[model samples]
Target: MILLFGLFFILLIIGTSIANSMFISSIIYMIYYGLPLEMIPQRMAAGVDSFTLLAVIFFVLAGALMNRGGITTRIFTLAEKCVGHYTGGLAHANVLASIIFAGMSGSAIADTGGLGAIELKAMKDGGYDEDFSLAITGASSLIGPVIPPSVPLVLFGVTASQSVGDLFNAGIIPGILLGIIMMVVNYFICRKRNYGVSPKASLKEVLKCFIWAFWAIFLVVIIRGGIAFGVFTPTEAAVIAVAYAIILGLIYKAVKIKELPSVIKETLGTSVSVLYILSAATLFSWILTYEQIPQTIAGYLIGLTDNALLLLLIIMLILLFVGLFMDITPAIVILTPILLPAVSAVGIDLIWFGVIMILCLLVGLITPPVGMVLFVLSGISDVPIAKISRAIAPYLVASIGVILLIIFYVYLMTLNPSLPKLY
Candidate 1:
């Protein structure tokens, strides 16, 4: 296992793609152990042969379609009108727009790439500092995977054998709470910096913006409502989302039929990238299981601390450290199998644990060194990575606060029988 991880890191440092790194390391481990090479392709095939993964394919397509369909602009316009009068109004709207956009697009990259451009432009035009605008945009994009229809949550669910609907449900409160806390933190920061507010929209204007955005907003409600009411599975929800996005595009005349080929091509590229990582990680995880590495680690951790709260805190810290170095997708694939048993031993609910794991990992999207969202923002804004990292520090602290709150809430729910389960 040590050799396997060492080889993986060496490959990563040399600029190999994550999927390729994992595949190379797995092959090395198999040869070293004298295992048959044939097992590799078999496990890789088994990795992606999932009914639930169909959701990932369609969701990726739906996000791509919506990006090209002009849904992002409507959502942003509505967010700005709804909250543009608040302290740090654009910052607040950045976060608000993320929450709304998150419902439509379950991907943080989608949120950062699609909406980051518009939000940063709005902030710059409004006389905001470039670093500050970059920070807020990157930070708020984390909300994309925390809300329902989240790609990470779906992956986590399928990996852990938890219900995807339950994971989505569990995320609602934490996602909203995190957004609100960030908004409050932005308020103070903006007030201290004297960031000016936008002109308040009149009641009629607010309604007008809302009316224009109603179709986009309705997509969120329909997806979550359908899942919660048992009207559709998460997979079904993704298909519906694609259909709805197409309908929206046609109705608004924003998405022409001619553009779909390119949209589909883009989705295929993104989906293939994700599926490849998942496939490689699946084989890597099988190697770990075959070595009993997960059991060994779980036993050691369980023996290290009997206090569930302390154990959870320790696990979260480890995940945060891992997130600093890894992308969330492969991290979810590799870590879920290793950590789920340890968490189960500590008496944490799998659904709650999944949410917490995702929240911690999403924070990494804005973190330094390998922060995917940071890179995305830097590319879009032409800001130095260091400047964006420095700007995002306070927002990082606020996100930590939200993570702590979730940990406490999970503890409370575990203790109280009368507490309602989001599942």
Candidate 2:
């Protein structure tokens, strides 16, 4: 196993794509261990065979379609009209837009790539500091993976063998709390910097923006409401979301029919990238399970401390560190099997743990040295990664605080049977 991981990192250091690196390392491991070489293909195939994975594909498609369908502009307009009057109002609008966009697009890369461009432009044009604009854009993009229709949550559910709907439920409160906390942090920063604020929207203008954005807002309500009411599964919700996006595009005449092929092509590219990584990670995980890696790690951790809270904090630290170096999808796929057993041994609910794990990993997405969202924003805004990383420090602190709050909340809920059920 050490040899396999060594080769994997060596491949990564040499600039191999994550999917290829995992596949190649797994192949070498099988050859060394004299396992059936054919099992590699079998495991990879099995990785994407789940019915749950279908949701990921559809959601990726939905997000891509919505991005080109003119939803983001309306979302941004509505966010600005609603919150642009506050200090650092555009920053507040950035966070709010992310919260709204999060419901439509579950992928962080999508949020940063699609909306980051627009938000960064708005903030920069509004005379906000470039570093601050880029930093907040990247930070807010983390919300994409925390809210409902989240791709990471779906992957976590399948990888951990938990209910996707339940995981979605667990994310709702944490997602909103994280956004609110970031907004608070933005409020203070804006006040300190004396950032410019927009004129307050009139009742008429507010109503107009709201009416224009009503369909986009309804997307979230319908998806969440449908799942909560058992109107459809998450996978079905993705299909519904796609249909809804298409209908909106047609009705608004914003997304041209000629644009769909490219939209679909982009979606296919993204879905293929994710699915391939999943397939590779699935094979890698099989190797870990076959060697009882998760059990050994779980036993060692359990031996260190029997206190669930302490153990969870320790795990969060480790995941946070890992997130700094790895992308969230492969991290979730590879770590879920290893960490799930450890956390379950301490009597933590997998549903709540899923939210914690994902949120922590996502914070890494905004962290330095391979933070994907940071790179995305930097590319879009022409800002240096170093400056963006520095600017993101406070938001990172706020995000970590949100994670700690979730840990405590989940722990308290475990102890208090009177608390309302999250799902």
Candidate 3:
């Protein structure tokens, strides 16, 4: 097991995709264990044959559809109305719009790419620092997971066998906390730099734009609420979201029939990559379990520290380091199962762990070398990573603060004293 683990890391470091890396690693392990090659295809196929995982594809499609629908403008317009009077108004607007849309998209890259252009251009026109604008936008996009319909949390629940609805609800307070942290920090920066502040609009003006976006955001509320209340399953909610987004798009003329091909094509492209990685990771995890790898590692860690919080903190640091080079989706898919039982063995709540896992993965979207959100924002704002990295210092601090909160406090808020009997 140790030898196989070492080889996996080597393949990963050599710039292999997680799927290819996992496939190779699995093959190596089978040979090492004297297993037949025939099981490889079978295990990989079975790993991906999950009904819950269908939510992954649906969420991706919903995000693409929402992006194409006229909802993007309504969201931005609503954000502009609410925050355009603040110093660094456009920057705030971008972040605000992302929080709203994150509930819909569940992807930081989608938030940055879809909503970033307007914010970047507005901040530049308003004379804010380019690096500052991009860095803030990039960091703010992390709110996606914490907000709602979080892809990472969905993937985490499926991988770890936690309740998806509980994980979604558990994210609400922490997500709001993250957004508030960003807003306060951003406010300080704006005042310090003397950034532009738009003139205050009338109540009527604010309400007008919000009314325009009311239907758009209402869709998010209905989908999330319906799922939580058991009015619909996650799969059913996704179908509704797609239909709603399409209707709004056609009504507002934001999307047309000719554009359906492009939207579906993009959705299919991304879904395939994500699902394939999931399948590969599943087979890889099966091998790890077969060798009792997590059990062995967990035993050593328990010996090192019986204190649950300490173990969780240590694991978090390792995850932070992992985030530097790996993307969130694959990282969570790979690590959640390995670490979950260890944490739960110490009485950690699965829902809270899901939050921590998602938060840790969210950081990967902004960290170096593989910071997907950072790169997207930089391209839109035309800022260098070095400068963006420099500007992101405060947000890095904020994200860490959110992580620690979940580690120590969110468990109390999200978990019941006794889990309800499943039988």
Candidate 4:
């Protein structure tokens, strides 16, 4: 175990990719144990050999298609029309837009990369400070993974063998709460900073904008409604999302038929990279399992405290720390196996725990060192990482607050089972 992790962290410090780091570390661990080398490919193959993972690919493609189809612009326009008149109106709109976009994209990087430019440009034009604009942009993107149709949730489902539908259901309230809390924080900050607001949109204009963006927004309705009503599984929702995106693109003339090949190629590249990480992490995870690492860790955790609430708090802190160094996908894949036993041992609901886990990890996206959202925004706006880090403090705290609220909610539900379960 020491040999494996030491080499992995050393490789990470030197800038080795996560996938390569895990693969190399696992191979060395196997050699040290005199395990047959052939098991490597076998374990990697088994890792991604899930029907559920198809949702990951299709969802990636759908998000790419929607971005290419100009759906993000419509979504932004609609949000602006709805909330562009209030103090810090554009900031509120930024959060609202991300919440809506989250339904379709389900990936934080996708939301940041897709909707971010539009939000920043609008805020800049509206006279918002550069640091504030960039801060909110990065922070709002975190909502993407917490909402339904989320890529991370899908990965969590496959990793923990939990129902993706229940996970989606579980996330609805928390995701919306995260957005609301961020917006509330934005309101106070913008008021103190005196950020300006635009003239309110007339009801006629708001209606027109909504009509224009309706199809794009309805994608979420289809995905969430379908899953909630059992009309289709999450995997099927991905396919429908792709088909709907293509159709919506054609209707808007935003995505030409010829442009699809490029979109597909982009999707393929992204999907393969994610799958590669999963495969390698699976091999690494398999080694841990073979050595009974999960059981040992679970035992130690239970020994420390069998109290469900306390164990969850410890798990949340560990996830937050891990998120500082690891990308969310590989982190979910590697840690879910090791941590689920500990979580289950404490009688915490796995479905609720999955949402809690994802929420905690999402904060890492805006945090320093490995905050991918921060890095994306910094590259786009040329803001210093230091400034971005400082600017994001309020929203980061808001996220943690929402997470704590959920934890307390779960604990309360445990005390009284009559409350509707998060699942």
Instruction: List TM-scores for all candidates, in order.
Output: 0.98, 0.98, 0.94, 0.98
List where candidate 4 sits over 4 angstroms from the true fold.
none
Candidate of highest TM-score: 4
- Candidate 2 clash figure, as a count: 0
Q: Candidate 2 at 244: error in angstroms?
A: 1.3
lDDT at 296, model 2: 95
For model 4, how does the per-residue alpha-carbon lDDT over 317-372 read when each residue is reduced to its tens digit?
99999988899999999999999999877768889999999999889999989899
- lDDT of each model, Cα atoms only? 0.90, 0.90, 0.80, 0.92
Against the true structure, candidate 2 reaches a TM-score of 0.98
**Model 1, which residues run further than 4 Å from truth?**
none
Q: Candidate 3: TM-score? A: 0.94
| Residue-level error in angstroms, candidate 3, position 230 | 1.4
lDDT of 3 by residue, 278-355 (tens): 878878888878878788778887888877778888888989998998888778877887887688778777787888
Better of 2 and 3 by TM-score: 2
Best by lDDT: 4
Tell me which of candidates 1 and 3 scores higher on TM-score.
1
For model 1, the run of ten residues with the poorest summed lDDT: 414-423
**Candidate 3: which pairs clash?**
none
Tell me model 1's lDDT, rounded to 2 decimals. 0.90
